[model samples]
Structures are given as C-alpha cells and as structure tokens.
Target: MTNRKPPLLILLGPTASGKTKLSVEIAKANRCEIISGDSMQVYRGMDVGTAKIKPEEMEGVPHHLLDIVDPDTPFSAADFQTIGKRLIDEIAARGKLPFIVGGTGLYIEALIYGYEFSEGGADPEFRKEQEAYFLEFGEQALHDRLREIDPASAERLHPRDSRRIIRALEVAHLTGVPLSEQLAKQTKESPYEVILIGLTLERNLLYKRIEERIDTMLANGLVEEVQILLDRGYSPSLVSMQGLGYKEIVPYLQGYSSYDEAVYLLKRNTRRFAKRQLSWFRHMKEIQWVDVTDSSNFSAHLSAINAIIAGKFA
Candidate 1:
C-alpha cells in the first residue's frame, strides 16, 4: 500500500514552449489523458488566439475541459479546480494517467493546493465600475495599482489581464489583506501525488519562439477568430476577449489602431506574458526542470519523466 502512489502528472511551460505536442506524445505512449488547465482555452470559438489543439493534434488521446464555456460566462479558479479534480479521478479510475497541462499558474496551483475563495465575493456593480476605470486610465495604470498592493500577484499576471487584476485588487480592497497573502495562508491539501514536469529553454530562444508563435497565430487567422467572437455578440469587454491575442486585435478590428501596431503589441505583450509565467513556475519548489533547449533531448526528457513515474508509482 505504501508503494501505491496517487496518479497525477503535470506538463507545464510558457506559451509556445511546445507543451501540447509533448504532452500528447507522452499521453499516447503512456495511456494518459490530458486535462487542460488553461483559463482562456475553455472558451468556445476562441481557438486561434488560445492556440487550442485541433482534434488531429490530440492524436486520439482523450482531452478534457477545453472549450467548455462561452466567452461571456465567467469561469473562476474554483470552477477549474472542481472540473480538474473530477477529471483526474475519472481518468485514473478508467486506467489512464491524468496529465494536467498548461501555463496558467493559478489554475494549476488550485489543483495542487487547498484554498478557499469565499472571502473574495464579487460586487458586480463594483467590477463594472473597475472595468470602466481600467479602460479610461489604461491597463498599465491598473497594473501599477495592483503592484502597489499585491506585488506577487501582479508579477505573475499580465498587465492587460484586467479581470484578474480587478479581482486581485478587489480582494485587497475588501478584505484588507493582499491577495497573495491570502493564498499563502492556505494549507496544502493536494489529493494526488503530482509529478510536475517543467519544460524550459534558454531565455533568448524562448523569446524567439514566443515571437514566432505570435506571427503564426496572425497568419493562421487569429484576427478573424476575434471577428467571429465579436460578430457573435461577445463584448470586447468580456473577460475572455481581454486575453492576449483577442484584446490586441480588437483595436485593429474596430479601426482604432493599425494592423501593424496591433501585431507589434501582441508580440511584445506575449513575450511579457511568457516571462511572467516563467517567474511563477520558478517559485514553485516541486517542479523538476527539464531543458529542452535542443530538440534532440526530447526523448531524453521523456525518459526522465518516465523514470520519475516509475520511481513513484511503479
């Protein structure tokens, strides 16, 4: 009984670090199924911007929790925690490994720790007011405010992520406690024995990859993807539309900003986002960093992951 480890695996890396393909390959070879931990990827009709994996890319390995909500519907970290925990149980019961994959640090943290969000109850009217304020003074102003109160949370989140920034600010304002401190107070009560595998690369190469991916997304119709979302009556102010790609394109689509300007901002913001993601993961002590600096070491990385699984659960 002591040797029987709880089954849960995590494949984490920044955007454009090649998590999807590596996760699928590992799942295919090891009879594992993937559970997406991405906050934005849960929305429908927002594919290109979120870099969603097509069915073909999944290669027959079952995936869960992607495209499960509309752009307007609010999906919280608690919702993700509930869905992800259930999927892990169901997949393990069915004799497949449950691999939680994505770069969203808070969502992943929710799965690996116990925390109560009850203190941060929403004031819809106040949130709307904050949203309007954000538009007026700009995202940088909002981020600076958050940085003053909850520097840790601000560091982990992108400046343009108004929804989270608002929430963090709200928590601090209402509770008289910083959002980061509240999360820190939680007792770690993770149910599964999580083997967190982090994919890493040289900084220069990683930035290059992020830039190239932004270019690829634009070429692959990311702007058109936002056009469809707007055409469907999803507001530009919706939490989902405020995502990296969608938000950058909204100005260009509305003729307020030039296409080149939007593209430049997208690439710059994406690089910043990736840096925040890396900063977040680096703080977590459990992650086993694997350098995939060269593509040739991919097989070696897989072997390293397999060895960890074997050592823990075999």
Candidate 2:
C-alpha cells in the first residue's frame, strides 16, 4: 500500500528541550523551511521573552511565522492553521519540506488535523462574568475553574492563556460538552503525510535548561523589552501580556513585587508551562519521541532524527 499526501515534518517538544538548534540543523540539511509553532513567538517585539530566533541564529535556513503581529492583537490556533496550511503547500511546491518547529502543540495539531472551530455564538454576559472573575482572582484561579469542568482542555492550555480558558469555559457552558471533547471528536485524519518528531529530556535536566534559558533572557534585557511594550500602550490585560515572561514582570514594574520575586515566579511558571507542554504532546499518539538529554552528543541525536525522517519520507 502507498500513501500520496504531501510530506510534512514537525519537530515539537517541551520548551527548553533543544528544538530550536536541532530544527535549524535539520532544516539546513533537509532543505526545509521552518515555520514557528510557538504561540507567543507570533507577536512582534516579544523577541527576548519568547526566545525568538534572531536572524544571525537562523544560519541562513529560512524561517516563517515569527513576529507576525502586535502584542495586543489576538492570534489563535485557527489563524496558525490557516497560514500554516498555506505555507506547507507553498514550501512543498518549491520541493522543500515544510518543517514546523516549536513547543506549541495545539497550533501544530490544529494545522495538521484541520480542526474546525465551533461557531457557537458567545453570551456576552457570560463572557463578561468570566472576564470579571479573571480580573478579581487572576489567571491561575480562573484556570482552576476550567480544570474542574474540562480537565483535558485545561491540561493542554497554559494557565496564563485566560482568553482560551474563558472560551473553553463558555463552550462547555453553552454546549454541555468540553472543548477538548469537541476537538477529540473532530476527524483526526490529516491532509499530509506527516512525520511528527518529539524531543524530551529527563525532568530534572529539562528544568535546568528552562531555568538557564530564563536567566539568559533576563541578562539579555527581558525586563527592558517588557518595559518597551508597556510604553507602546499595550495593556497588561491583553492576552499577549499574560504570556509567561511579560505577565510575571508586570507586577514588578508596577511596584507590586520585587525584581527577585518576579524572576522566581517566571522560573516557576515556566517550569509548570513546560510540564503542561510535555503532557499535551504525550497525548498525541503519532509523535516519535527522542531523548536528546545529552548536549554533548548533538550529532548522535541529529543523525537519529534525520534517519527517522529519511526512513519515512525518502
């Protein structure tokens, strides 16, 4: 038997799992154009906090979908799917593999499986109440409310993503089925010959990398970056501002928390976020998981991944 869908390659994993360096190397060797699957990286001027790839870091391998919107604008999984699908086709047309590389599982899954978003109208009153609740109690408390009704959806969604949390809550309230259940019922059939590669590390080592990454971000002026965004008039209430690094720093800048307190919260929240990422990707049955815990053995890991890709796509 033979399958003939267009080839698509995805390199995804928890944050700080070495996806960035590996993806660029794989792309350069495989003649692939990389599209970012990270939700936060889509916003312009969020470079430091998102750990967005600098041009020099790309090493001439073409990348797409980074810095595409303002911090205040709302970008969602559906937007990623629409644009990602187009890029995949265009890249395939040029005889290059379209490699989606990032830790954002929902965005990648939505694009790969063609998730149809429900058009169920929202109740403004319900939505307003949810917003008010978030404002009063904060994102984690609001996220906990969703967890009670939709644990599956809650597991995949970041606590700071209050917008989606509210939507999931609304969907459950309106339709009586969890948003995760609706997505699970969606046709899982993909439009491409997809090869999903997942990277992982021992939990302790992964946490080390995450902490180091955050330290590097702070040293590289993450605070200044957030300050710039605030100066540009992006409100702290915007969904993008609720992102990991930005949100944690906001209280510090507003004189509510000390710099040390903000840093601690950022590191802890990032670790929790990474754990959620692993949980989400683990639920996707198609991914070929690889352990790249040893930074000293880069070639070994890359070779193994390339072999997997070649075996499937060659």
Candidate 3:
C-alpha cells in the first residue's frame, strides 16, 4: 500500500551540535519551513541563553514558533504537540516542506508520536499543593516524594528540578500511573511520513562545543539578558527560569553564587544536559544518525543530510 501521509522532516540533536546551522542550509535547499522543536526558544527575551537564531542568521528562510510566549507562561510537551501539529499542517498547506528542528526530545516525541495526555491527568489544586510543599520543605523533599511514586522519573530528574518532580507526582496522583510508565506505554506511531535525523559528535568534542557555546553566550550579554527578565518580575521559581542557561545565571545575579561559580555550573550543567539529550535520542527509533564531528567539511555534511531526506521523501 502506498503511504500518502504528509512528509515531515525532523532534525534533532544535543545542544551546540550545529543543528541550527545545518537545518537552515537544508531548509533553504529543500523548500522547507522550519518549526522550532526547542522548548526554550519559544520564550520571548530569552535569546542569548537559548542560543536562539538571530534574524540576520535566518538567511531568509521562514522559521516558526520562536519567541511566541512570555517567560512566565508554562509550556509543556502537550502544548508543543498542539501548536506544532497546527504549524506543520499550515506549512504543508502552503506547499512547503514542514521541518521540525531542535533538541528537545520530549516535545518532539509527543508531537511525532501523537502522545495522548488525558485532561483528567491534570489537577491545579494538586499542583498548588506540591508547589507549597516545595516552598516549605525544599526541592529534595519534593523530589523524594516523586521518588516514592516514580523512581525512574526521579532517577532522571535532578533534586533541584522541583517543577518536573512535582509534575511527575501530579501525574501519579491524578492518573494513578507513574509519569515514566505512562511515557513508556505511548504508541510510537506517527501520522506523518516522518524523517528523523540526528546530529552527533564525539563526546570530548561535543563537550568542547558546549563549553564554547556557554562562553559565547556569556560574552554576548547572557547575564544581562537574564537580569532583564528578572527585572521584568519573572520569578526565578518559574519553570522557564529553570531552563539551562537561565537557571545557572539566576544564582549569580542574586548573589547566591559567584560569577565564576555560575559560569562553571552553567558549562557543567549544559554538558550533562547534552548527555541526557543524546541518551534520549539514542532510545528513540528510526533516527538516521550523522556524525557531525568534523565540521570543517560543511558541504559534505549538508550533502549527507540532503541525501538522507531525498531517500525518504522522494
């Protein structure tokens, strides 16, 4: 039987893996309109920290879903799925290839696989109670609560990640199923003619890139950008603030950690986050992995990616 599903190209990898640059090249060549798969790039005024693509850097290719929300708004995988599907259809309707590009695994997974998140799974009161508990007892206690209900989730989440911890607990509380288990049971079926491409680098080289990216962010006013968000009355406790670059810098701005310490933590945490991203992608099925370690040969990499897309979509 011939599959007539809409074609969707996905370019994903860890932070600083050159997904942004490569996606742009491929998009321009392939008549593709790029929809950001990044969870953080959606936030307004968070450019430097998220490594958001600059206007001039876009090179005339249309990009969607960047700077769409305020810093205080909560954006979940379900939200990404809803908006992403709509954008993909819209782009496809306009006779452009729909390209999803970024490293946020959960959001990408939910969108492509059409993960169903039950409305009954959410309880505002339960969330409020967990937030109160986190405020009163600290993040470790909250994480400990998640550990009892969803050990796998706890194992993955850091103790300081109170928001995710609370979310895991809430999923268990309202749905009577651990968040990890629910995720594990998702039907990994896509409605689209999906092409999943992953960019990877050698571990040491990837870490070097991550560290260099952090340094570039710092040089480009990352601290000031974070301070501006704080000045706008966005609380550090907000989930958006807990993101990679923002979270590490908040402590320095608040005098909780020295600038050097904050930078050190940012580099270390970003490296760890990249490792987790690679781990998540490794577990996903059907990714055409490309080793982009030798970035000196840009044309070769672009050709390799285009060849992969042509094979799948032709």
- TM-score each candidate: 0.93, 0.95, 0.95
Give all candidates' CA lDDT scores: 0.87, 0.92, 0.90
Residue-level lDDT of model 2, residues 175-258, one tens digit each, is 988998998888879999999999989999999999999999999999999999999999998989989999999999999999
Q: Which portions of model 3 show Cα errors greater than 4 Å?
A: 1-3, 123-125
lDDT of 3 at 71: 93
Instruction: Write down the TM-score for model 2.
Output: 0.95
Q: lDDT score, residue 132, model 2? A: 97
Q: Give the distance in Å from residue 306's predicted Cα in candidate 1 to where it truly belongs.
A: 2.2
Clashes of 3: 0
Report how far off residue 270 is in candidate 1 (Å).
0.6
The candidate 3 region of ten consecutive residues with least summed lDDT is 117-126
In model 2, which residue pairs have backbone atoms overlapping below 3 Å? none
In candidate 1, how many Å is residue 281 off? 0.4
| Order by lDDT, highest first | 2, 3, 1
Cα error, residue 117 of model 3, in Å, equals 1.1
Please name the candidate that would achieve the greatest lDDT relative to the true structure.
Answer: 2
Output the better candidate (1/3) by lDDT: 3
